[model samples]
Target: MANHAKAAEYNNTSISSLKGADRVRKRPAVIFGSDGLEGCEHSVFEILSNSIDEAREGYGDRIAVTRHRDGSITVADRGRGIPLDFNPNEKRYNWELVFCELYAGGKYRNNSGENYEFSLGLNGLGSCATQYSSEYMDVTVYRDDYRFDLHFEKGENSGGLKKEKCHYPHTGSIIKWRPDLEVFTDIDIPLEYYQTTLRKQAVVNAGLTFELHDEYSGETFEYCYQNGIVDYIKEIGGEKSFTEVQFYATQTKGRDREDKPEYKVKLEIAFCFNNEINLLEYYHNSSFLEYGGAPDKAVKAALVYEIDKCLRNRGKYTKDEAKVTFADVQDSLILVTNSFSTETSYENQTKKSITNKFIQEAMTEFLKEQLEIYFIENKAESEKILEQVLVNKRSRETAEKTRINIKKKLAGNVDITSRVKKFVDCRTKDLNRRELYIVEGDSALGACKLGRDAEFQAIIPVRGKILNCLKADYDSIFKNDIIVDLLKVLGCGVEIKSKHNKDLNTFDLANLRWNKIIICTDADVDGFQIRTLILTMLYTLVPTLIQEGKVYIAESPLYEIAVKDKSYFAYSDKEKVDILAKLRGKYTIQRSKGLGENEPEMMWQTTMNPETRRLIKVMPADIEETQAVFELLLGENLSGRKSFIEENGYRYLDMVDVS
Candidate 1:
């Protein structure tokens, strides 16, 4: 009886509910999805969505947002101002319903077209929830030749509602609020967030202008896309696109189920296939979908189906060839999808995605029909797209095979004694003290090996000019025995940037055997070419080695000055000039011979000795410019190469091997 009495203490009265503003102020993540900076940013988006909805409904065309220096945000829109007076039907003031209540707004009767038909803020929770989560909020509305103002602090009404008659040029609302520090752990939204969000909104909402003012930076930015997604697609595709931009738009009314009500849907798709650039963006009701749900599925399904059907009809695939996938098409495709629906089934209140079954079905069917017509009408474009997508597919498959083979070939402990040919390793196992010298040939390698510190220095010889990695494919480049042996000697695996070859990315800096990888080549045209080829191989396959400051160039003397009983080495013309100016006795100057002809003492003093030799660290600060130059000189850029050679060929006239 005593145990039963103790348990019976938990009764109906024990069940408590959060009341008024406490409902949202206490558990903010319940509505905003988090209590961190993301939630604070979503709160700002919630307010901005209301303004976007008003502008999208044709009530306005311009919206202004401001990021105040004091951590407040303001969103002002030129639209039909929010009603703040009394409501006869509900027998409550509109101010109370909009500012205090949670689920109260004018967007519910969307199908009737009385309010917002296709709205971004349809849940009726944005305005009130944002107000409740604010430390202080000031709302100003201009309508009916009257200006109404309301102020709230800490989720409570302050000074009630203030109404005054004034002559205003436009009817709209301006809301400035500071998110509460107590409610959220972080509220410092960055300017980049606003720029990206407003740009995406402008892309979806055609002809709507969004102006952002950052008081912290004292700068203003404007985003307006007159042609909407079409313009965005062109901007993303740039001049590298092979196909002209294609735009398709349609609207339909449908229902997910017989029991569900029918709603209207509008879809706009803009796409182009580019060789150098690719992007995929999806938006619904002006909200960018970071995690695309329905439209993503629809696009993938329709494109694969239509493209595969076209390829089969044209007999482009062999008997045993596999069908293309979305990845294959996506490799060169730049597309943007903007869609809206009156009755949306959002995945959550944050509104990152929608799960409406009818929307997906409608979009998929519409895209399939349009694509079939497009392929039939534009034969040239269809051919180009088909060829490019096939190339991508075949390349992806080959890369996959190459990745698997390379992983298997390069995996395991690098036993240099038996696996790597002619790779002389240092006696020490300490990576910090070890060095690897990549010399020109076997003769140069013999000289370097004889002169180098055997306790810490190792030597590997490149037979001749290895494969030009910048101009060759991965399979062809890796097939070279010299390159394979060099990589095996280095012990650190390669890094491949392709998504298909991601699994083959076995590079780990800790696995590198040497502290310094010194490229030691003769100072001649052929040696320069050999050095460039070796550097290109490292740049393409093991870029991380250069980025981590592990690669270096061993400077070989260009001139050897023999005087009395001493010889001074000069690596450049300036060094030779300085040395000649400092000489006090009769001396004979002679151009240095190749590394193969150098004596062991000369090699040690000039190239192998750490205390006397000069090494240039290969920095990766201008890596992009280096890559562009490499591509122009060796990769597939014939016009660029021609232009560069024509403009700057004179600089290297002496270095050219005319003989």
Candidate 2:
């Protein structure tokens, strides 16, 4: 133990002692795992896991996560606090020891059969790993009438807890850590990402209050869901709902199906199928599968099969009926499945719980029992819902028919290729090197094409104001020439025809090829509208493109300052002010009303040139919040969009173009 302790000690180490960030560079994976957003998410996961573990141990209820002003993070929890003691002979406090030492925590007591049972930080290296990866870590502990504090710099203990006696004391733990700049090359934490996952956690752990503050943007939010996943389901499926029914089931391991080795499996699932187009499925831990595992698969399969069987018995489903896939089941359904296990194993680094195979069998039976009772008790309502399913079946068939016609149009098997002539496509087939600039008008398109590297950049000019496909259906979309051309260029294959020869007119989803899709419309109101239209279509129809980071918005300079023989570009009003101040000599300031205003050379220099162009990358901070906003803005209802615009339009409106 002494040898191990001595080896773990980095007593003389300092931030300056390391060579060129090698401290974090040497063990990059130990900190973020990899150098990307995933690693950044892993850091967040570590903090969240620690907080959740504290909550699970009944030591904390309130956890506060703050995005510090200095690209750091502080997650403080009201828990029993990290232990601080010494092997009187070792002459060190346990809390301080834990801070610098790896594999040192009560979470690993499972080997000893200690009371510290389940936890999110089972590896016992979570905090230590964080400390080692961070440039600095401040840990303060208040527990059992004593207060303890410790600080570390670049994986080395910089200071120790003060031994002074205190007048008052509280019980909790606070960890403030700054991921070493040397470790993580990029530092862009989106508040929405944290909000989404944390809010979900609050819902999964009923009564667990989670608070988040983004000092960068002066934004803060608190989440506390008393009803847990039940409320979560209701939130997602707002107006899309059916008969409200909650099921509670418990099955002792041996008494139930003799499938696997376990003591007991207990869980609760709440669901209500609605008329909405999307399915809302929430997974969890603690009576919920945090990262849905085998149990989720088993439950879903059983429910769909049972629904098919029950409907068939009632003469509602035909034997030759197309088997409704999971995607079909989710068309208008909101489901929350909670599977609890005495022993839980995570599938990946994010610690998404996936343990116990028999859980699926157990959950299947539970869902069957509850759904059966529900169907029997509400036979009329169930039958009505089934009728709705039949309607979906018809709509799907119609949509499928439309799909075939579009395929022929896209495949170039007929004269439909003429419809795509408006697009100025690049000759390059290399997806990684190719980019598309959806310019507003012919003038901007001409400038972009002239300024672009013809080898990879493609320019497509929209004729006047483009059609807004927000509320448009497949038929409406298929009729629009602009949408058809864009779709054909994107390589999202045309819709295939049904078995029966019919003009279904559907959009094919396989033809998309451009890796970098930039919406380079002007910075004015019209440009904003065009951008919105394109985003709405892309987000609604092909979301994976955005998810995969293939979409971006080009930042065109609003102000071009030509002083003497030199020219400078300013993207924002503040930048213009600063640049004008820097160049005090006589100068001519020109405001670019739109992309069309810029000459080909100026356009390339300021917006189209890869070497100098500025681009805004969209990232979600609070997924749930984003979803709510998207629904409010782009949903079928006009009231939500109107109310949202009324409340927040001022901030969003481009004042420069608002005239």
Candidate 3:
């Protein structure tokens, strides 16, 4: 043993050097999740959200966001301009404090719902963080018959704020920032995100106008909503829903809590049933929460309870009839639930989820009252909705029975030693922590089984192309053995008996046997086809797999070039070129047509080892885009497919990035 006292000295150093803006620059991911395009794009979101919050308070009618060719994002809102009053505490202009100070804002005027109406920036770090992360920020505030111009570089004020006579006729603010390359390297703001976000905001803002001008794409879109949420639901649902009746309800509650006079709540709820719309675009205050929060949870519960109440009043169901569930109702429900609070709590600084119980309770009671009244008034529409609900309930009952029957056979046996034959199972008793690799051909399976970590990795050998769930019904899907084995492995059950006991629709991801379900195929065209088929099936039958980021595609190199003493794996022709440029001696390049072509050792070294292997996460960033591709490429229309292939076939040559 080495001497304890004289061992190599290790000193603990405190990072006191980091301050304000420097802190944001040092830890970019904590602020923006990445130093990539997402971070740069999110910076724009911070600015736009601040402007939209002003509009939320009926201060602005028009807001414009633009992406410059020189790589700057600018947001201008015709609202009460950023305040210029002296803040006695900071002994600085309020506008200066707004940009420079972290977590310094008026969003938290009240802890209760009294002043809950706000936007994306909740913590003091929001806009200040954006400022700190930016290379430079320019501001122009027009208010009180004066124009205030301010500029800052890397969170430091370039000069004092300047006040001048305002020749313009309007009162508002303009903010533009260039994302620092040192902080967010080579990142461009994603226009699609802003476009989608603006469209959503248009619906909720009602009369507000949203404009986007993109210099990179040379595209401009202006969005205005006269009908607000109603128009949005109609457009998204399209002809898929009963076009005649879309129930719209808006309500406000006076101070319900005597002790909490500030906890005032307001709700603007709109809903329509469309078979195609499975989207939940939930907003708290003004910030969009992708997964929803307390508001969504409350609305879902209220909807089920109220629907059941309506059914009982109309004598539509027997007392023994089962209560409706979210699974049965979600597909047909197109809902917009917006909650305004004077105060609210978020799960984290990300502000992705709201946790206020009051918003949930308020939404539940309000929607129930509105829905109950509508059901009583519109008898025919109520019957139409009830019939759909009943059909869904019956389907759920059949599915649950099917599930119970399967569980009865496999429940006691924690180790599925004799239950499944298609898969070469791993020794992992904890199903959720393991990984499942779906490979084509038994030969490929042999390679995976031999190369895999038997403790946590399992292999399933699939033959040819699997059934496309998009073209097949839920029941027909489970009848196929391939899908049945898959469902058993995933533990996410297939859907109800819509017609037969085959629909594999409903699935709970929590029960998934594998935390990561990877589709491992060859690096050939047929392999691509197999991967697409598998993805299409999962995208349709178990969409939550993709939504929850559990789905992945294993990237196997197409070519392995052994140059001199070193080996380089290239997935694309471009990569091949890049690799060849650095080679100095004779090289041998081997193209792998299938996994069978590679030996077990090679497979383990190149594609199976955790440190060396690459896995592409299948994220649901744009579900609509995914769905559109599925419809066009799957079995929807052949002629349209032909036209699309003829027009865009060459694009496939460069699609090496996808796999």
Candidate 4:
């Protein structure tokens, strides 16, 4: 709860001998990668990784995350308690040193063969770095019949571990801490984010069991999957038209000489294809390869080669196109590629991958040889997959051609005015100092155009409802007249006429005419629909525009509380009610139904003034979810749209306008 400044004063340090702490603080990017939300997530990963490492060592199985009522999180694991033995000469218990120190875990020396093969946790700096970035932390260790506790504020230990009386038959460790408010500007961690991640981990770890409870919100859940990646494939693939199929294979060869035991390479690929377009792949190292490295390339190459060979032999594909590119066969595919190696030197302290290139090559060769035999023997399934790939190839070509033609027209500027004429052009040419007000209907558009900022403000009055971009691809999208005009006005040079087109300039290189695109719609269902349409287009075609902080939606008051001569604008019903209570005898409240009904001065005072206007910037929390929603709403599937509306209609905000 305390501001980050005080915490940093105690935690921040520049000592050179503290190698792990220095590395993390100096090159935080190397450890957590960024100072943004993703990097904050990395801190959670660091903690979870340590717990998982215990499981890999065959010492821990159950991990629980509890969100305290006060907003702090506790992560506890039942693993072999951290070693407490002391080197009499060093005179320090290893458990205390490891918790307070950096780069201090046993997996570094391969004490646990499971993790030595593949890991995804910090060497020693993870916990220490987390401590540095947190305001307060407490770690408890249960080892050798003794319970010990260490407390720290920032990074410095406030005091030594206090010997604790045994409370129960317990082992492993428990860490309770709150991230520093200064380092993490976001004080509230969304429960859904944690839920999504922990559920995913449970799915990936297979036999691992995880329990989570949020005391703040009274939410609790448990996750475990005995089938592991196979269950993951089914869950991610959802109700898609694909059955779970796992390809199992392995290979071995002597490491040094004939006397050496054969070093083995094991590979497991679980995959399924749906009726969608892009590919989804989850890679890991022995249940930890977060992203596949050489191992991935080997397996994919073999899989493609085998499928291509089968297709060609069955007279389904030509020998010329028999070399299948990974992308071609990945249409609507959900895949998991996991590999285990006895020897590795991955750059990451977490050891997420096996870097040895030789093992990758070996895996590829083994797959190519064995997969060829399997597919040849199971002729029916192989032919079906080959046919699907061909269909995907054709669809891809058509989409590309459409994209090219649209871009050509946009760049060529061949009178792309099917809708541009409807926009009320602004006279000013200066872009940075200017802004555009995109309003719904001619009524609100007329008010905005006359509100008198012609020198900087342009008004675009959109007709009826705009296109929902989710269901359409790039080609079908450009066909919408309203969408094309909006892009042109915004200085987003449209793809058109070939790059060499030297004639009448179609591309508007004129210094961008507006710096802000503000959506001002009526306070009604139709208005919300129009705003969503515009937002969808920006999300798909010009995501960078939003990311760069250029798009915003204007907040128009729903209720205009007019008591006698004085007027107060209320953006919500609650505000209107509160305002009415204060003016109990002096006023009669009037709720304005729409922007058009409000006089020019009232509109400027409540919704247009730079000082008073309340605007909401659209930020996509999950790109995948946005994409899926858009596809369902706009795609040709009427049933999907109906289902979505029925399921989520309750979430829609009620809008009111005083007319």
- Highest TM-score model number: 1
lDDT by residue for model 3 over 527-621, one digit each (tens)? 88899999988877678888889999999997889977777899778899999898887999987657976777778877777788899999978
- Give the per-residue Cα lDDT of candidate 3 at 194: 79
lDDT of 4: 0.68
Model 2 residue 587 lDDT score: 96
Q: Worst 10-residue stretch by lDDT in candidate 2?
A: 496-505
- The local distance difference test score of model 1 is 0.91
Q: What are the lDDT scores of the predictions, listed in order?
A: 0.91, 0.69, 0.77, 0.68
Q: Candidate 1: list runs displaced more than 4 Å.
A: 1-16, 110-114, 497-505, 557-594, 597-599, 632-659
lDDT at 529, model 1: 88
Off by over 4 Å in 3: 4-17, 29-39, 85-90, 106-120, 243-261, 313-321, 399-659
lDDT of 2 by residue, 183-210 (tens): 6666567778788778877877879999
TM-score of each: 0.90, 0.60, 0.61, 0.60
| Candidate 2 CA-lDDT value | 0.69
TM-score of candidate 3 on Cα atoms, chains taken together: 0.61
Output the TM-score of candidate 4: 0.60
Estimate, for each residue in 470-544, the C-alpha lDDT of model 1 and write its tens digit: 878888867788998898888889988775677778888888889999999999898988988988999999998
Candidate 4, superposed: residue stretches over 4 Å from native: 1-27, 69-71, 88-91, 110-119, 164-167, 182-188, 247-266, 277-279, 285-291, 318-323, 347-354, 414-659
**Best-matching candidate per lDDT:** 1
